[model samples]
Target: MSIIKKLASQTAIYGLSSIFGRFLNYLLVPLYTYHFSAAEYGVVSEFYAYAGFFAVLLVFGFETGYFRFRDKNDPQRDSAYSTALWFVLGANLVFLLLIRLVRTPLSEALHYAHHPEYVEWFAIILGLDAIASIPFARLRAENKAFRFAGIKILEILVTVGLSLFFIAYCPPLYAKNEQVWFAPIYDPGIGLGYVFIANLAASGVKFVLLTPQLKGLIWGFDRVLFRKMVGYSLPMVVIGFAGIVNEMLDRALLKYLLPHDPLMNMRMLGIYSACYKLSILMSLFIQAFRYAAEPFFFAYADKSDARRVYADVMKYFVIFCMAIFLLVTLYIDFFQYFIGREFRAGLGVTPILLLANLFLGIYVNLSIWYKLTDRTLMGAFVSLGGALITIGLNLWWIPHYGYVGSAWATLACYAAMAVVSYLLGRRYYPVAYDLKRIAFYIAFGLGLYFAREPLLTYGYRSWQAGTLLMGSYLLSAALFEFRGLFHFRKKLPAGDSGKSLGPGRK
Candidate 1:
């Protein structure tokens, strides 16, 4: 129980920082949507969709590989770290060179021929970020939650501050012939390019701050360790690329398959992308949980009650995700204002995408089975299957249903992945997950959401009805789980302080 408490604390630190940082970044959604047309913003969205693939590709899953190999106090720990770090650094260097060589033709192929610089900037951004992942992973391994959160927040601040300076401040000043000193740096022609520049600068700042973690590089790479880590992590790369396909392929494919003119397709993509931001809370929580939970799981793997802890974690994760789903869907009237008017047309997809993200979070939790059991190849198979589902559905649906089709496709992909992962997990590394309670929470949340419209017939305002439904759900959850939570806590063995399995303990 103490271990669970520590995990919660780490998760809280990571989760709160992520929520705040991403919320700050989330503010930029309104800025972009308001300032740029849907067509213009779609270019930014498309580039980022491609970035997701390379982000996975360049790192080659070495972050998790390092965690797997660098166990506490192992003689080869430093070797594992250095080998993984050097390998990633070398790979990214080659990746950047390739991007440079192909930037022109690649930009032309992507329909951004006039601004091949976009390709160049993103290559550097992704390379820097991939290099930094190992250090971030090391932080998780070490349980340095505060430092990790601080650095993450700092990066977000840099990105958000620079974005505001370039997009919001500079253009108005340049137009009025004011701030002449800043004039030389500001380029109105850059337009949406400013967003990418802000992100690139942020990645650079994060990379610089992580230089201390690069000290491991001096240990030199080990051929044996490098080969082993690569063997383990290659499947992770496949899993990651497939995961990207599941998450981003819709945005990537929308423009090509929309059955509309190029510009209109971009317009629809922009609207869909903007509304997708409404799922930020779900995505951000999952990300923060992943940061904390991955290390926690590895560290706690030998514990007698680890499976129980994992099951509890899954239930609570579902509860919280359902809460986020309802929070966004029920109060959508307020959340809709977060994007500009043009993007509001795609708001109907918000609940679908949010639920999809919820399922993705579940899959992320369930995936620990394969990671722990060294069955990553099986994980790859599941993710690849989901990716294929996403591709086929988007190809068939986008032509008929437009962006809404993409939304449903995402939900279908994630839900299918979660189910498949869960079934496979039971076979290889069973955790008696509380499926009934999990299902109840999900069904209850959805029931409340659907009940909202019917309840409005009673003359209650949307806000009032939403508040009442949310309150009811909270009360039911508390009533059902309070006793179980307390019982678990009471059963903790005497003298168990529940501190983290620190550096050498694991």
Candidate 2:
């Protein structure tokens, strides 16, 4: 329990950036949806969907690899860090050069020949982010959560500031035909492209700020260590690629899979993407938890009680996720306003996507078994299976149901992945996850959500009904789970005269 508290504290600090800073960036969803047409926003969404795959590929999973190899007191930790850092930098540099060579052909193939700069801009963004990932991983390994959070927040601040200046402020000023001081840089022709430019600028700023951590390269690379790390981390690339396929393949495919014309397909994709942002609350918490829990899991794995600790963490994670699930679904009327009126038609997918992300978070917790046991290949196999499911379902259903089918496909993929991971962990690295309670909470939260429509006829307003449901779940959770918090310590056996039982035990 104490260990869980430490993990929670670290997550909270990281959340200062992940939740708050990203919330600032998350606000841009509305800005784009309101200011741009659905088809225009779809252009931004599709490019990012493509960037997601490259983001995973260029890193080569070295972020996790670095954490796996570096420990607090290891004499060779510097060699491990230096090896990973230099390798990632080299890989990203090669990637950028390749992008430079092929940008024209790639842009033509993607129907962006007139805007080849989009390809170059996104390529640079990906390379910069991949290079910066190693330093960020080092901060986690070293328990420098404050520094980590500060840098992350700084990056997002730059993103938000530039986005507002280009997308919101500059447009009106340029439209007025005013000779503004910033006129030299503002290009009205960029239009929706401003979003990508803002992101590229943010990545550049982050890379510059991370220069101090780049000093690890002075330790010099180790050829032998690099091979071992790559051997271990390469399978993680498969896992990550599969994970991206599960998450983003829908957006990438939607523009092709829809039965409608290309323009309408893009408009539908834009609406789907806009509603998808409604799940940001759940995604934000899971991300912050991952940042804290990944290193914490590796460091604590040697302890005898680590499995018990992981079990406790899993239970608490599910509870909080269920709370998020109910919060979003019950008050969805309020969240719907976050996007433009044009995008509100797809709001039905919000709950489906939120539940899907909840399952993904559970899989993240279950994934510790493979990482700690060095069975990453098995993890890769599980993720591949999910990816197959994602691909097959999207191909089959997208033509018929459109974006709604994509949402359901996502839910199905994550749910199957989580269940499979839990089953595999039981065989290879078992933890006594409280399945009964976890299932109960999920069912309970869904019940509250579905009951809202019928209960609205009974005289309560939507908000009033939502408040009652939210209060009921929270109160029930406190009483059912935290009853142990109030337990009095029992006396030790008479024969145990000189020994203490444990913390919180008498």
**How do all models score by TM-score?**
0.96, 0.96
In candidate 2, what are the lDDT values of residues 386-411, reduced to their tens digit?
A: 99999999999999999999999999
Model 2 quality (TM-score): 0.96
Candidate RMSDs in order: 3.6, 3.7
Stretches of candidate 1 above 4 Å error?
Answer: 74-77, 486-506
- Model 1 per-residue lDDT tens digits across residues 1-506: 57767878888999999999999999899999998999999999999999999999999989999889995886334788889889999999998999999999999999889999999999999999999999888888888888999999999999999999999988888888865788778888898899999999999999999999889898898998888898899999999999999889999999899999999999999999999999898998899889989988988887766777788899989998999999999999999999999999999999999999999999999998889988888899999999999999999999999999999999999999999999888777778788999999999999999999988898989899999999999999998899878886799777553333221110
Q: Relative to the unseen true structure, what is the Cα RMSD of model 2?
A: 3.7
The lowest-lDDT stretch of 10 consecutive residues in candidate 1 is 497-506
